[model samples]
Structures are given as structure tokens and as C-alpha cells.
Target: MSVLVVGASAAGLSTVESLRRKGYREPITVLGAEWHLPYDRPPLSKQFLCGDWDEDRTRLRPDTMLSALEAEFVLGDSAVGLDVERRTVHTASGRELQADAVVIATGLRARVLPDQGGLDGVHVLRTLDDAAALRKDLLEASRVVVVGDGVLGAEIAATARKMGLSVTMAGPQAAPLQSQFGPVVAGLLEELHASEGVHLKLGTAVTGLTDEDGRVTGVRLETGEVLPADVVVVALGAVPATDWLADSGLRLDNGVVCDARCRAAEGIYAAGDVARWQHEDSLLRLENRTNATEQAACVAANILGDAQPYRPVPYFWTDQFATKIQVHGRPSEAAEVTVAEGNLDERRFVVHYRRDRRVVAVLGWNMPKQTRLHRHHLVHA
Candidate 1:
């Protein structure tokens, strides 16, 4: 059967690779909006932004490996519409591709502030091109302000500080990743950033941007104070890229709603950040890199008649300065956190989050092996 995947990122690539590995020798086509080949995105705010890794180094795979897949690579064109019944995808370049089975993996678009558009020196880090532009401005910029306290924003602030620029982080959360890691762990993270020379402007909302002569000068806060900056990077998070499927007759909420099998329709399936599929008794959509490939494998299996449900333990990781943090399962701010291993004061520890005596998540701060071992508790619980 012919298959068409409407994204060329890790999710789309993983589906195709899984199908081939499972001995499905049918024709496959991978469509991508960016002109560049599929690349890793985790390094965009770290290695790529800090000029440690080049564009070529970020590539997911080399030409020789991709050529072995024997799939048509359609790059630099974006999908404008999809015909659900006909299983056809309409592209911006007027190319209509029909396949027996279709997979949606469009991923997400970076969120921006109200006045962020058309403002010079304001940036967002999502794609490779975004990293290149932000890095270029950062090299010449003496002061930089990051407008978010989430993973991306914290990472950007760390990278900029390491690059010797005066950096500041602004967000409504009390600390970086407070919502995800809770007050205790997030408090430690705040201390780490503060010690590294990054200014903390937390627990306050950013009102708007101040610009003079079409160039951004500073970020205005809700309290009427302005954080001066030569460059500003907005890391407020992202939303699913499903505007093109607005009229595709598919259920769209936070993402493309799907069944436990990840099937949105008769022959239409979805995976990765754009898919909100059922997991046990709840609807879940994960935006991390691990879920992309894991969910794609599940989709490929079901497409080949495996008929297994997709239930994965959510995973995500981030690197800042000399720290590498890895998390498994869902950790909420409301959950009770307990240190399961090591010592938090030493900056190498593993913490477990629990609700009603049931462990909900595990986190590792500079302790990868022990953290992974603790994840088994989540699986067995």
C-alpha cells in the first residue's frame, strides 16, 4: 500500500523507518516544509545557539542512510489542505498526493507575544533558521532578555549567559519550570541560574515590548518596569500546527484527536506533537522528542495490523550549563515530592513525585543512571 507522511521530522521519519523494518515494502513519501533535511531540535537552544554545533552536525541522518529508505523526499513545500475521504494531501506548490494510508505529523508552531511580530531584535527559537538568526543577533548583542520560564526559555538564558552576554529571564512562574517540577526542584534551578549571572525577573507578567525606530529596546512588565535588552527571545511555548486541517472534517481540540490506536479516521493516523490520542482513561498529547519516535512506532505497528494500543510513559530532558535533567512520567506542582536518592544539596539527586501514595513521576538532576533505574518504579506502579 502507498503511504504519505505529511512531515519529515523525527516523528515522520520514525514511522517510515519502522514500516520498513517491519517488512512493509510499500511505496512511501515524506513531505517537509523546511528546505533543510530532517534535523534534531533539542540542540537548537543549546549547542546550535551557542555555536558549538554547526547546521550539518544537527542533521538526523546522512545522505547514504536516507537514500536507503527508497522514499520520495518532497522538501520546501507545506500542506495547505487534506481530503479525508480521498486520503489526499494538497500542498502549497499545487501538488496533490493520494495514498492508501495517510499520517499526520505536522508538529507545532512557536507561540509569540501580541506585539512580537514585525519587531526587530525580537526572536523565537523553534527551527534551525530561528537558531541561526537568534545566534547572529546574540553575538552582537550585549544584553539579552528571555520572555518565558519554561524549558526553552531557561535553556536559552543559560546558553546566552555561557556566551558571556548579560542575560535576564522573565515569566509569571515563581521559578523556571515551576509548574512542571514544583517549588522545591524549581527553586534549585533558580539558584543555579542566579549563580551563573542570569537575572531572574519571575512572578511577573510581561505586558508589552518597547521599541524605538522599529527596533526593540526593552520588555515592558505588568508593574510598569522595563527590562532593557539589545535582543529578546520569546520562549512562551507552542501550539499544534493544525490550521491547515481546519476543514479536513477531523476532530481538532488542542491537537488532532484520535483513538487509542492513533487513528483519526478510517485510513488516517496521527503521531507526535500534533496528535492528542487516548491513553488509558485520559486524552494525552506529548511534545517531547522521545514521544515522537515512540508514538510513530506504535502507529506503524497498528497500520500493519498489529492492533496494539499506544500507552507510553512521557519523557523529556533538558541541558543547561553543566547540568542535564531528565524526567519520566508526569510531574505536577500539586504533587508531593520526595527525594528518593542522592542529595539535592550536592546538585546530583533523584526525586519522586507522588499523589495519594502513588508515584506519578521521577526526576534526575545530573544523575542519569539512577534516574533511569527509578523510572522502573513508575512502570511497575
Candidate 2:
């Protein structure tokens, strides 16, 4: 059977690799909007931006490895529309392809602030080119302001400070990452960033971008204060790349709505950040590298008639300077958080989050081993 995968990132690549492992041995095709090969994204604000790892090192699979898959790869061409009735995909490069089965792993695109007035220094990090362009600016920038409170913003602020650039992070939340990790853990992170010389302007809104002669000079806030910045990186989150599937008749909520088996429709499946499926009686959408890999494998198995539910304990990790933070399961669902190992004073610890007298999740601050030992508690949580 001919299969068409509409993305070539982690989720799309994992699906193809896992399908081969399942012995499908059929003709497969991958369509990618970016010309570069699939590359790891976690390092965009870490090693890649820091110039510690070159672009070549970020590739998920080398040319030699990908040649073994024997799949037709169409890079630098984006799929513009999908006709599910005819099992056809129309591409921007004027190609019409047919497939017996389709996988919509098109993933996410970074959200941009339209009112930014098309300033030269305003950037959003999402693809390889975005990071490369921002990395060059980071080296030359003296003062930078990041507008977002999520993981990407925090990581970029941390990376900027590490590069000796003065970074001021502003977000609407009361504290950074409080919504995801809750108040206690987020409080510690706030202190960590403060100690490292990052100016935290939490609970603030960005009013506008101040530019001089078509170049961003600072970011204006709601409180009538303009934070002077040589460069501004908008790390606002992403939305699913689902516009191509608008007329395809598949359910589209926050992403392509899928069933417990990750089936979007007959002969169609979805995985990654673009696929929001049922998990434990709730519709959950996870946008992380770990979940993308797990969900893709599950989708591939279900496509191969394995008849298994794609239930996974969601996990994610981020790096900020010397600290490596990892979290398993949804800690925000827990009402109480208790320390399981190490102490915050030592800058290394594992915290256990519990709900209704049962452990639900674990968060680690440079303590991966202890956090891993407690993962079994989440299986039934």
C-alpha cells in the first residue's frame, strides 16, 4: 500500500521508521516544507543557538540512514490542501499524489504577532532558519526582551543570559511556568533565573513593538513602560498546522481530533503536536518531543492493525544553562507537591505531586535518576 506522511519532523520520521520496523515494506512518501532534513528541535535554544552544535549535528537522520528507508522524500514543498474523498494531496509545488493511507503529522507552526509592524529584529523561533537567524542576532545583541512565559521563552532567556546578553523576560502570568509546574516548582525556577541575572517581568502584557527606522528598539508594555531592547524574540507558543486539512472533513479542535486508536478517519491517522486524541477519558494534546515519538509509534502500530490503545504517560524535558529539568505525567493535575529527593537549596531535587492520596507526577531539577525511580506510580494514576 502507498502511504503519504505530510511532515518530516520527529513525529513523521518516527512513524515511517516504526512502520518499517513493523515490516510494512510498502511504498512510503514524506513531504516536508523545510528543505533541511529532519532535525532535533529541543536544542534550538540550547546547543544549536549557543553554537556548540552545528546544523549538521542536529539532523535526526543522516543521508546514509535515510537512504535505507527507500521512501520518496519531497522536501521544500508544502502540502496546501487535502482531498480525503479521493485520497489525494495537493502540494504547493504543483504535484498531485495519491495514497492508500494518509498520516497527517504536519505538526505546529510558531505564532507570530501581526502588529509587530514587520520589524527587522523581531523573531519567532520554530524552524532551522529561524534559529540560525536568531543565533546571529543573539551574538550581536546587548539587550534582549523575550515575550512569553512558556518553556521556549524561558529557555531562550536562559540561553541569552548564558551568552552574556542582558535578557528581560515579560509574560502575562504571575510567574513563569506556574501553569504547567504549579506555584512551588515555578517559584524555584523564577529564583534560578533571577540569580543568573535574568530580569523577570512576569504578569505583564506586551503592548507594542517600538521600532526606529524599521528596526525594533524596545518592547512597550501595558503599564506605559518600554523595555529598551536591542533585539526581541517572541516565544509565544504554536498552533497546529491544520489549515491544509480544513476542507478534509476530519474533526479539528485544537488539532486533528482522533479516537483512542489515533484514527482520524478511515485509512487515516495522526500523531504529534498536530494530533489531539482521547487519553483516559479526556481529550489531551501534548506538544513535546517524547510524546511525539510515543504517539507516532502507537499510530503506526494501530495502522498496522495492532488494535492497541495509544495511551502514554506524557513526559517532557528542557535545558537551561547547567540545569536539566524533566517532568513526567501532568503535575498540574495534582493538588499537593512534596519533595521526594534532594533539596532546593542544593539546586538538585525531585518533587512528587499527588492528588487524592495518590502520586500523579514527578518533577526533577537536575535529578533524573530519582525521578525515574518513581515513574511507576503514574501508570495507574
**Which candidate ranks first by TM-score, i.e. highest?**
1
Q: Could you give candidate 1's per-residue lDDT for residues 1-381 as a string of tens digits?
A: 899999999999999899999999989999999998999899999999999999999999899999988889899999999999999999999999999999999999999999989999999998999999999999999999999999999999999999999999999999999999999999999999999999999999999999999999999999999999999999999999999999999999999999999999999999999999998998899999999999999999998988989989999999999999999999999999999999999999999999989999999999999999999989998
Score candidate 1 by lDDT.
0.96
Cα lDDT for residue 112, model 1? Answer: 96
Give the poorly placed runs of model 2, Cα more than 4 Å off.
none
The per-model lDDT (C-alpha) reads 0.96, 0.90
RMSD of each: 0.6, 1.1
Residues 239-349 of candidate 2: C-alpha lDDT, one tens digit per residue = 999999988888999999988999888888899999999887899899999988999999888878888888888899988878889998888823599988899889899
Q: Name the runs in model 1 displaced over 4 angstroms.
A: none
TM-score of 2: 0.98
